[model samples]
Structure formats: structure tokens, C-alpha cells
Target: MSLRSYFLSSAILMGAAGIIGASGPLQAKAHAAEVSGQPQPLPLPPALPTARDVSYGGTITLNVNATDLQRHILTMQETIPLPPDVSEKGGDFILLYPMWLPGDHSPTGTLDQLAGLKISAGGKQIPWVRDTVTVSAFHVQVPKGTHQLDVSYQLLTPVSPKEGRVVMTDAMVNVQWSAVSLYPAGYFTRQIQFKPQVVFPAGWSYGTALRSDGAQSGHTVTFKTVSFNTLVDSPIFSGKYFKKFDLTQDDKVPVTLNVMADRPEDLAATDDQIKAHRELVHQANLLFGSHHYDHYDFLLALTDKLGGIGLEHHQSSENSGPRGYFTKWDKTFAARDLLAHEFTHSWNGKYRRPADLWAANFNTPQRGSGLWVYEGQTQYWGYVLAARAGLMTAPQVEDALAEVAAVYDGRQGRMWRPLIDTTNDPVIAQRAPQSWRSWSRSEDYYSEGQLIWLDADTLIRKLSDNKKSLNDFADTFFATNNGSFVTSTYQFDDVVKALNAVQPYDWATFLHQRVQDIRDHAPLDGFSRTGARLTFTEKPSDYIESYSTLRHVTDFLFSLGFAVGKKGVISEVLWGSPAWQAGITRDQELVAVNGEVYDADDLKDAITAAKAKSAAPITLLLRDGDSFHTVSITYHGGLRYPHLEGKMDGLGAILSPLSGKISVTDHKE
Candidate 1:
């Protein structure tokens, strides 16, 4: 790859070509061969693709039957109305299975699940072949009299939760078109139109943002003809037990809440939560100053039997959570900002998308290098809208900020890996399990993303002398002439320009430094800007407890630099934590502490006990590699946890955003 090596190879190739030209012309060539036997430059892979046409050749009708949940199978049949122009090229036709699904951020379409796939016309089966190179494509030669084609296939659903929880069940089902449909390959997704119909299990109710015609007898429903893009974006949920709630107010900006649960009691939400969701809608409109959907549907699944999903879309979101999602609202923590977060996506992700991510066809994989803005910015707004809507208290927000700082403050990965590098992990890693996630740093961009935007929001307030905030950036960046659903793409410079327009600064360098560089410390400057500083206290913050309880896991993660999951088993040992130093490793069981039975609380007490007496180390009986050994954790930093404390007279500025109350008190900088 050196310059001298490159020139040497180029001269040698030129001399060989000249000698071959002087001798004779080669008359024969083989597949993938160069005539003169010299190596050739490889062809590049496909880049970003755009839609060639916006009009469809004709409407295709697709019908699916997914009522057989016990068998975990879905049957699909489609009628293609092929026009003359479609077969203008050598009478060869190509069909494409949906790939690179929007919002899933990868080519997660269930192609391997396809079974018994066949295409036919004129009462005879047409011979078809799967393209060797592009596995998602099928090629068929149309006969002289063939004017249309019929396709049939059976889609196998996942029987296990780990494979994917998004499929169907006897109680309820999630219907994603990408799993059961295919379309002509020549046209763009938005140019291919489809009229879809579904027959669900009898006596089940379903909810989707798709424009529906009406429900027919016994669980059959039909949807209006829509572009392939729109149909794929619209997913449906059907449940034997279902309920609907209206979170709308004054008939303006209608936001509907559709809940489908496994049990009857789970459908009931308290009046207070109902009111807060309506306020969530209000704060979203107030913050972004725009609406992009005709009407929004917040489809929620509260289940223990089904897999969990939180995919965002243009008109609705697929949000599923643990059992007792509503009945145990007091103890369950998912409801706080689940709806608020997805609603923000309506404007930030679905309406205004990153330019590279806005591929005209689902065939082209969306480059996730910009998800730092797409998901990260939305995550920032999710927490803000939650607090503003009173779903989370001001204290909770402070605690959350503290945890964010403590985490990134010691994130071992940031020592080598930059925050921006995490954007493409969902695709690169296929969202797979990781052994050393802290060191590998799968997706710190979501949390660190919040920090960067937080700093910007605080910077805007300081630069404008409290004249404006991120609200200006939000309104200007997402605004449109109407609230109708439409998409506009933006680049990194567009975001920088918008931030600069709100309050002038070298935002380009500011962002690049925070995101594009590897730093030893966390981005804690957002705290000082908000008039607060991050400090650790002996007691755990509300954010820490809430996060741990929700995940059903505990974090000695920041404290001892280790985390334990269910049954007191060590899930991970941080690279340089007290646990790791003491020789505890992942998959090892914390059997006992100080000759007492081990539990999360017992470990905490032992740590506290070690601090009480400097000579006494926390003794742990760990089950490591099929053998039990006693280990000692010798550290004096007794019970350390993160919390945000107000800086000199800066409490007002910090509390204003959290509580929405203007501070009456004033003080020094």
C-alpha cells in the first residue's frame, strides 16, 4: 500500500500489457478472467440507490392467513398484475423479498423462513431460479401469453423468544409485511402498490396504523391500496384480549392509544397515567412545533407470553413490555417514557431522516453512521418529554443525569473507541450478544448521544442569554407546511447549520471533539452548563434503582465494576473493577459472602462492612470454573453511587428544565 510499491506494480503491469499488445490479441476468455492473465480491479459494491419512478405499473393484491399460531406458521398468496412495460427487457422478470427494513436498521427480513415458494401463470408453473449472487432476488422468464403471475409461500414463525419476539401467538400476533410479502424488483418500493388483506384467528381484535377498509365477518380485514413503502411501515397487532384508549384532547392532533394484553387485567391503566400520556402528546407538539402523521397510533402490547418490541415507525410504534405493564404500574418502570420516546420519533426519525439512511428501496442497506442523531436525539427528547409531561419527576431526571455521567465517566471503551463509531453496530453485529460489552461498547451512542445534545441545549440557553433553547432547533429542524406524514432527509452539516442558526458557535468542532475523539473522561460539561455538578453519594440514586429494577438486573456495574443478573450469577466483571481484581469472572455464581448466603444486598452490606474496618476485606465464596473459592475485595470506597448536586446558586437553572418552574432565586456564576 506504500506509494513506491503502488508505482512499481503499475509500471510492471503497463510493461506486460505492452509486450502482450506487440505479440498478438487473445481471442478467448473464461468467466471472471482477464484475457492477458493480469489481475484486474475488482468491481465495487452497490452504493446508495434512489427511486427511478414514483408511479406504479399496477396494483397487486396480497392475502395472508396467520390464524394458526399453535403451529407458528403464516401462509401468504399474492396476485401480481404485470403490465407490458415490466416485461420489456428480454421477457425476464425479477421479484424481491423485502430486505433492509426501515427502523429495524438491518437486513432482518425473514428470508430463510420462506418455504414452498413458487410463481406461476396461465395455469402452468413457471420455472424460477434464485439469483446466485443476490440471494433475496428470484428470476423468472415470462411466456408469450402470460399477462400476470401468482405467487404462494409459507413463512415459518419463530417458536422461541430468542429468535425474535415479534411473531404471532395463539393469544395475539404481530403482522409485519416484510415477513410475508415480496414485490417486483425493477421499481422502487414506493412505486409498487399493494392491496393487502388478512384473516386472523376468529374472535381476535387487531390494531394498526394502516388505512383500513373495515373488519369483515370473523377476523378478516382489508386495507386500502398503498405503496409498498407505506404497507411495510404499517404493522398490525391482533389479540384475543384487547382494549383501546383515546389519549387525544380537543380533537386536535389525534393520538390514539391501543393496548393489547395477554390478560384482561393488564389492559386497565390508572386515570393519572392516562392524563400523563395526553400531556406527553401535548409536550411533544409544544417542543417540536409540528406533527407529521395524519393521526398517530401508539400500539402497545403488555404480555409475558410474547416477545418484546419497541420499533418506531412513521405513524405508530411497536412497544411491548413485561407482564403487568399496567396492573403493576407502581412497580413496573417501562411506562414512564415508553410512549414519549416513540412519539418523538414521529418528528425526528420518521419525518426528518438522515440522508444516507433514506434509501429509495429497502434493498439498499441503510448506513447507520448517522443513528447518533436519529436515535440519540430522540432519546434526549424522550427523557425531556417524559419529565415535562410529569411522567417522571424533576428528581428522577437529576438522578438520571448523574447515572449518565458516572457511566461514561468510567466507560473503559471510550479510552480507545470514539462514541461516533458505535452507530453502525446494529448492522455490523446483527444486534448479537456480546461478552465484553463495556470494552466492546455496542451502543453507548444512545446514552452519550443524550450527553452531547444536552450540552448543546444548555449551550443554546447560555449563548442566547436564556432567549432560546433546543426548542428552537427542534421547531426549525422538523417544521413543515402541514402536519401530514411526509419525509425529508438531512445530512450532518444540516444539523450543524440548524444548531448554529439557533445560537452561533463552532458547533462542527464542538460536536466532532465530543463524538469523534477518544477521551479518558466522560462528557460531564453538560452538567456545569445546567448549573449542576455530578458527584457520587453513598446512597444509590432513583435513576440507578429504577433502571436496575426495570431490567431485572443489578449494577454493582459502576460500584464494584461488575453486574449480576437473576439468581445472583455474575453477568459481567468489568476490566478493572474490585470484582475483576478479586478474580471473579462472568458466569461465576456468587454463592456466599462472609460465610452468609449471597445476594445483591448481602454484597452491598459486605462492601459497607469492609469500609467500616480498614483491615477487614469483603470475603466472597465464588463458584468459579466448577470450584468454589474464597476471594477478598479490598477497597475503602464504601457504597459509592452517582448523584447530581447543584453548584453555587445554580440550582435554579438545573431545576427549571426538570420542574418547568422559573427560579425566583439568583446567584453567582
Candidate 2:
């Protein structure tokens, strides 16, 4: 019989035997009546107070002591005055620590480092509770007639980089106010007033945008009163060794370059070096056609001890350089653009911000959908300004751009992910290391965004017969409210409008197609329009040599599809490349190359030798954890490093000096 007939007969027999019957529902219901343990989540507590635009009655006084270098601890005492209604009724009070920090674009507040928190009012201690949700908030019951509360806390700085950013060391300290203090939650940060005082280590010099109140008592200095927003925007860098240079010229606004170093020798900047920095300011002014801050400060730290940073603010920026920034300026060409990058942020990111990124308080989340313009354009201008100011040669800048182009051209992730989606990487990944970076695509908006702006600039130049470029857009978009530090926010439409004003084109469609669409190839039309092309050579460019020296890595991505760091450890592997196809992965140590102990040069020689014959394959012995494996990669492409060729007049015009007469100097050692 067929299988269906046999099943039907069995069902009939079972029904007759009472095995299947109409009482099935009752039996199932009886089984379902048994207990099954399950739990439901409890309702969350009330939300924190929303920030308002009203005034916060009185000034908040904050005092910080940062002398404990041995323990890497910074102690802070803050006094927050309550509003009239809160003081009279004596109900619930809330204090919020900054979470969504600017520049970070993520909730990176170091709440884990905050310890020894104490709150007192009217000479009596008050019990405080951390909110179940939004743990950055602290809730307390305020007693009637209590006008203010005294809060004390300690910021336990990381002793090593593995824990967090090392903000303090025996030689220097970086004091970010947001990391050390808390503020009332009900008012806008700009509506609250703050008076800050810091006690630095004795004999240490510091630089900050905060104007001194001229009230210094030995080691402590008091700063003039400022809004809470400004207090958080201004940070301090203090060190045992320091140097200051005046970059102000032909303008009422004062721009100073304050540098601190790990040693006194590292602070030695030559006259030419200082001149280049001054030219940076000049070129920036010429490009934007205006200045925002009344005065600007560049707080630079030349140290290997303190954690590296390149954060931007309205009137100042925090930057870190190699210990050999000035002492070995020729070799440190790779780091020369840091100051220019951060300085450009003063006009692009600080004065002109994305509408979605602006928030009333620091705890509110910031949307980074517009970072492509905020950071990407700034990055493009940074390289241009650096070359214009003689910080780097035109050739070096072209080489760097070639490297950027090659990287995006080889990015396998572009096939699946669009450039616009990578803007969310800051929050989605929090900069965590990924096993397949080439496939996952981490923060491509910065470099790829640079390419997009370059494409726009070249297109504008072409359309306007070299009469207009992104320079016009900068002058038109960011030059508003001259000398005013008030932030002006913009939306996607605003960007398109500004570009249209510069040179009329189908900018909306152009941007949408490039940013929102997934494609197999990178945006390379900019190079072609600029009379240059990305090409590969058997040898690396000077920029690549310097980059490799600084990073201590071998660049075999184009040939071997992998980059090996020091001690024969693999740092990166391109997805779907020959090495990847051979099962080679990152963090694996290359034990041998063709039966010889692994060496960078030896591997390169092996690759070169394998190119001569069709039957030969590059043999590699790799170690992953305790296991060992042998793999053969059939890549015959000899050593290939990206370089730019062809006429560079279009790029030269874009990178030409816009300010004063500046001579281009060769950056080669």
C-alpha cells in the first residue's frame, strides 16, 4: 500500500482503540495546567529631568586637585546650588555625569572610573541612589531649606593603556572637566554658570582656553567664570617641561601654540617649524575668510607616556605628538597634520555643527549622521592646509592620498555596506577591534568622506572653470557670524544648498548615489579629474616608508594580502585575498617562510622569487594559539605599493598657499 493509505488506516485503528479521540483537547489542557516558571521584567523608574533653557540661579563652583600622580587619581569637589523651587520644597534632586561627549560621538563617559562619591548639604550627609536605568545619573533627597549641595568624587585614572586612556603620568596630566565633575540636570548647560579652580603639581606649567582670574596661590589657579558648557569645552594640559610660541599676526585675534613635552629637549622647535605653524593659522583664515574665537590656543603634548589625543574645541584643541615631533621633524612627517586637523575643527565642527549632533546637555545622545561633512571635510582640508603651510610637501600629500585611494579601492566591505552606514560605526562598534575589518568596514566615513569632498571640489573646479571650489563653500558656509563663537547648526539640505551656491550642479543626486549606494568600486573620479591616477609600483613611497617606520609594521596587503607587525605577528588580513583564501588569519605568528625563519625581507624575497615560475607557491608556516599549520598562497603579484602618477596641476592648485608667500620645502630626509 502507499504510505498515505497506510497512515490513514493506522489513524482509523488508533481512533477505534481510543488512542486518538475528541478528548484530546481536555488532555492537552490538563497538561498545560502544570506550572511553568517564567518571570517578567519590572517597570523602570521615572526618567531623569529633561534639560530646559531657563537660568540655573547661581554659579556652580568646582575645585580639582591633580597632584596624585603615583596613584593616578584626580580628586574633585563640586558645589551645585539648587533652584528656588527645589530648595523650598526639598524633594528629589538629580545630578548627571557627562556621557555623550563631543568629538567622541558615543556614550564614552568613564563612569567605571568614578569612585569615592560623597554628597553633603547643610553639614549633613545625604543618601544617594544610582538610577536603575541611566546609571550615569545620581538621585538624592534634598532637605528643606538646603540651598546647595557639596559633592566630592575621585576620578581613578588608568595606570596603563589597557584599562583606558592614560590621562595622567609622572610627567604630565590631561584634565578634562567633563570627566571630573557633575552638573544639575534640569537646565541647559549653557544656562548654568561655573567657576573652576585647579591645583596642579608644583612647578608644572599648564595651558588652557580658560582665562585666568589672576588669583594664583602657589600651585592653585582660579579661572574666570564661564558657562558650564564652556567649562567642559576647555581642558587643561600641564607638564613639567613646556614651551610657548606666538602664532598671531596681522589680526586682532591671538593664536598661541602651547607645547608640553616628556623632556625639555623635545620642546625644541626651530624657527622654521614655528613659521609653518603660523602659516597654518594664516592659511586657515584665508580659506574660511573669518575667525570665530576671540583667541585660540593649541594645547599640544609631545609625549609617549600620556595617551595620544587629537580632540577639538571652540577656542582650543588638545593634541598629542610623538616625542620626536620637533627634534626629529624630518622623520615625523606622518604626524605633521594632527594640529592642522584639530585646528580645522574650530571652524568646521565647532562653529558649524550638524543639527542632529547639537544637544542641550552632555547626557543627551548625539546623532552622527552628518559626520561625513563634519569630520570628512575637515580631514580633506587638513591635508591641504598642511601642504599649503609647508608642514608636508605636495608630493607627500599626493602619496598619502594615493594610499587612501588604494585602501578604499581594496575595501571588500563596500560590496555590502555603503559609506553612509559607516557613520554609525562609532556607536555600533565603540571602536572595538574586529576580526574582519576589511569585511565589516569600520569608520570609512572619515577617509571615504575625504574622497567624496575631493570629488566635489574637483567637480566644482571643472564646472566653474577653476574659478570656484570647496574653498568657496568654506567661505560661504562657515564664514557666517564672523568672530562669533556661537554654534551654527546645519542639516543635509543646508550642505546641498551651500554646494549649489558655490557651483550649481545636481549635488543631491551626486551625494545620494555615492553615499547611500553599495557598489563594487571606490569613488576614484576625483583622482582622474585632478589629472592624477592611482598606480602601483614595485617600491613603496616615502610616505609609506615613514608610516611603516612609525607604526612598526610591514605592508604586504597588495601582494600577500596581509600586514605583519613586530615579532612576526599578523596584524591585518584582507578578506577574500590569497592569504585569506589560504586560511591565514590575524594574530597568527608567521613562524617560517619557505623553510626559513620568518623575516619581513625574507618573505618579500620569497614573494618576488615565486613570481618567476607558474608552479611555485609561497609557503608559510603559521601558528594560531598552540596549533601550527602550513599554507601555500598562489599570489604572483610582486611587491606592489600605491603611488600617484600623471600631471598634478589640478591638485597643486587646490593645495597652493592661500595666505602669505610661503616656499615649498622638500620633506624627504
lDDT against the true structure, each candidate: 0.78, 0.89
Question: Which ranges of candidate 2 are over 4 A from the true structure?
Answer: 1-37, 660-669
Q: Could you tell me the lDDT of residue 45 within candidate 2?
A: 58
What is the TM-score (0 to 1) of candidate 1?
0.88
Q: Can you write out model 1's per-residue Cα lDDT over 152-261, one digit (the tens) per residue?
A: 99998888876665477768899889888988876678889999999988888888888677656566788888989899988898898998888775435567888898
Candidate 2 lDDT at 220 equals: 97
Return the number of clashes found in candidate 1: 0
Q: For residues 1-669, what per-residue lDDT tens digits would candidate 2 score against the true structure?
A: 432343356556755544235367855653455334344233345678889999998999999999999999999999988989999988778899999988988998999999999999988998887876889988777888999999999999999999989999988999999999899888899999999999999999999999999999999999999998899999999999988899986765789999999899999899999999999998998888787788899999999899988899999999998888898888888888888999999999999999988999999999899999999999999999999999998889999999999999899999999998998998999888888999999999888999999999999999999899899999889889777778999999999999999999999999998889997888889999989999999899999988887778999999889999989999999999898999898999999999899999998888888777574888999999999999988877889999999989999998899854222221111
Highest lDDT, which number? Answer: 2
What are the root-mean-square deviations of the candidates from the true structure over C-alphas? 7.5, 10.9
Which pairs clash in model 1? none
How far out, in Å, is residue 230 in model 2?
Answer: 0.8
Compute the lDDT for candidate 1. 0.78
